[model samples]
Target: MKSEPEYTPFELMAVAGARELKDGEIVAVGLGLPVVATFLAKRTHAPHITILFELGVVDPEPIHTGVGLADPRVWYRAKILSSFVDMLGMVLHRGLVDVGFLGGLETDAYGNLNTTLLGDPKGKFRHFVGSGGANDIASSARRTIIIIRHEARKLNEAVSFVTSPGYLRGYGERASAGLQGGPSRVITDKAVFGFDPESKRMRLESIHPGNTVEDVLANLSFQPIVPDAVSTTEPPTAEQVRLIREEIDPERVYAG
Candidate 1:
């Protein structure tokens, strides 16, 4: 146990993020950590995986984060350079995307995300940013995966605002209203969470090493139900972390 590995915050979360992609799956990585995980996967495991960026770049042979789809780096060896609308509406909305990876400013216990307005009615943001294509991706993605560095406030009961929708109330109630593409898996700094099939609420499945249920629950927005017997989240092997932090991002990206 002592000689196993020691992972940094991002590295740990990145590992959890990477596992969300299977051996072969098309993942629509939002950017940043999600991108890091995808790149890591391309290098270490999912050689045949297709990573599509919101900016319309596909299968970019990037060693680090590009500024955006239009960034020269993205176009250098990319397979596609289409438009955002076409990608989301025509491609993504049609369920062509296998996974949609998202990073968030806040995530509710049910995995509801708030990435746009923070907390204000008049314009006060607890944590704000341009939403980009989050809305479409949330509603039409084949499946959604959320990547966030876990903390108490960020994973609170009430987000200052509603950004990307998640298990707001429940499934049937939501489906009847026509809201689609809810959270599939939520990877965080502390643990990996998934929706309970029955309750349809985000439930703790595993704990990260050096972290505990108490640690995670202590900061959650609402009380998260622990599976009768919870277990520790499997951490990345030293090799996986090194591949992402070093081999994959050899250039030390300024913006990923």
Candidate 2:
């Protein structure tokens, strides 16, 4: 019997991210791995997925991954190229977005993401680009999907600042604050997490192949609810590996 194709963690991550999106869903995608994942989905199972770039490029059939969100390469064959207002105000805030893809420097148990700072916000701290369109996307998109590296520092008990609201404190908190959508899934290189319906606390959904639940817990500072039986993340098919390497991200811009 022919053995299954070997795949890297990043390839597995891309496939995992692609699986979260459903066909015909409208996604507001961020940069890097999120872009690669979205493109992979569009090329494969979710061909009709509508992609919206924060900079106002809509449904772009990018020939290759762009250097940045503004790069012209990402806008190739775009159905609409407009301004931030059109994309964020007209489309996103209007509740047209089905899913929002995001990445961050830190995320807490409640799914609150912090892309703004590293240290104390009130005192000395390392500052990062606070939020481009992440806030709007997180708030209004029907549901949000976070893609980030699995590291102890990135997963915290509480982020330094709440750049993008998840559940705020917990369940019903978002509704009380008049927030719309909340975080649904978080995809990492080692595992997949989903929030509990009652407490809104993060819980382990699956562990990637070759990684155990212990491997995942060792990297997290806070405890995530682990079920008695956790599913293994399905590895990317040989075709998915080929599509990622040959068609989607040939230059290794994002997937690499």
Candidate 3:
């Protein structure tokens, strides 16, 4: 009998994130692991997925995960190279986006994100790379997918600031505030969390292999709605691992 292949947490995270995307969906992809996952989906399952960058890059077949969002290498072979206004105002706000793929410094039970600062906003707070169109994407995209590290401090009861609105306090609050889309899932190295449809609280959908429910719970500042039984995340297949190692992110730019 053959045993399962070895895989890194980053590879597992990327494959797990990629599986959430569907073919032909227009996805607003942010920098970091999300870029890797989105491209992996396009290469394997979601070939027709339309990738959108905040800087107005649409359907760009990136040669590699670039040094930064502005790196020229990330814009190679684009279907449409446009402006921020066109992508955010014209496309996103128009309610045409299917999925918003993003990463942040922190996330809360409500799925609210913070890429801004750690300490109290009114006090001495260190700055972080602020929401560069993440706010727009999460606000208008039909659904948003967040990928971030799983740590107690990073998974707070509430984020320092609401850089991107999730359920925004509860179930009807987002709609009350006129925000179109809400967070769909939060994928971490240890687990995958989904929001409760009624209460809008985060719930443990699955735990990554090698991690237990207690392990996942211990990393979160707030308790999530865990079910009686949790599924294990599907690990990356041999082909997917090969693609990630050789094609998608050979340099370990983002997936690592």
Residue 62 CA displacement from its true place in model 3, Å: 2.4
Taking all chains together, the TM-score of candidate 3 against the true structure is: 0.98
> For model 1, what is the error of residue 241's alpha carbon versus the real structure, in angstroms, after optimal superposition?
1.8
Clashes per prediction?
4, 0, 0
Task: Output the lDDT of residue 149, model 1.
Answer: 67
Task: Give the TM-score (vs. native) of candidate 1.
Answer: 0.90
TM-score of each: 0.90, 0.97, 0.98
Model 1 bad stretches (over 4 Å): 68-70, 122-127, 251-256
What is the per-residue lDDT of model 2 for residues 1-256, given as tens digits with 9 covering 90 to 100? 9688988788888899999999999999988888888988999999999999988899887776678887899899999999899998899999999999999998999899999999977899999989999999999999999988999999988888999999998889998999977999999989999999999999999999889988999999899889899999988999999999998889987777
Candidate 3: residue 69 lDDT (0-100): 70
204-234 per-residue lDDT for model 3 (tens digits):
9999999999999988999999999999998
1-256 in candidate 1: lDDT tens per residue? Answer: 3688766777777777777787678788776778778877777778888888776778877644567655676556788877787677677887887778887788886677788766675765444575778867777776788988677778877666667777776656547658766788888878888988756788888888888788888767688778779888788898986786676665646212
lDDT (CA) for every model shown?
Answer: 0.75, 0.91, 0.90
For lDDT, the strongest prediction is: 2
Task: Please report, as a residue range, the 10-residue window in candidate 1 with the lowest summed lDDT.
Answer: 247-256
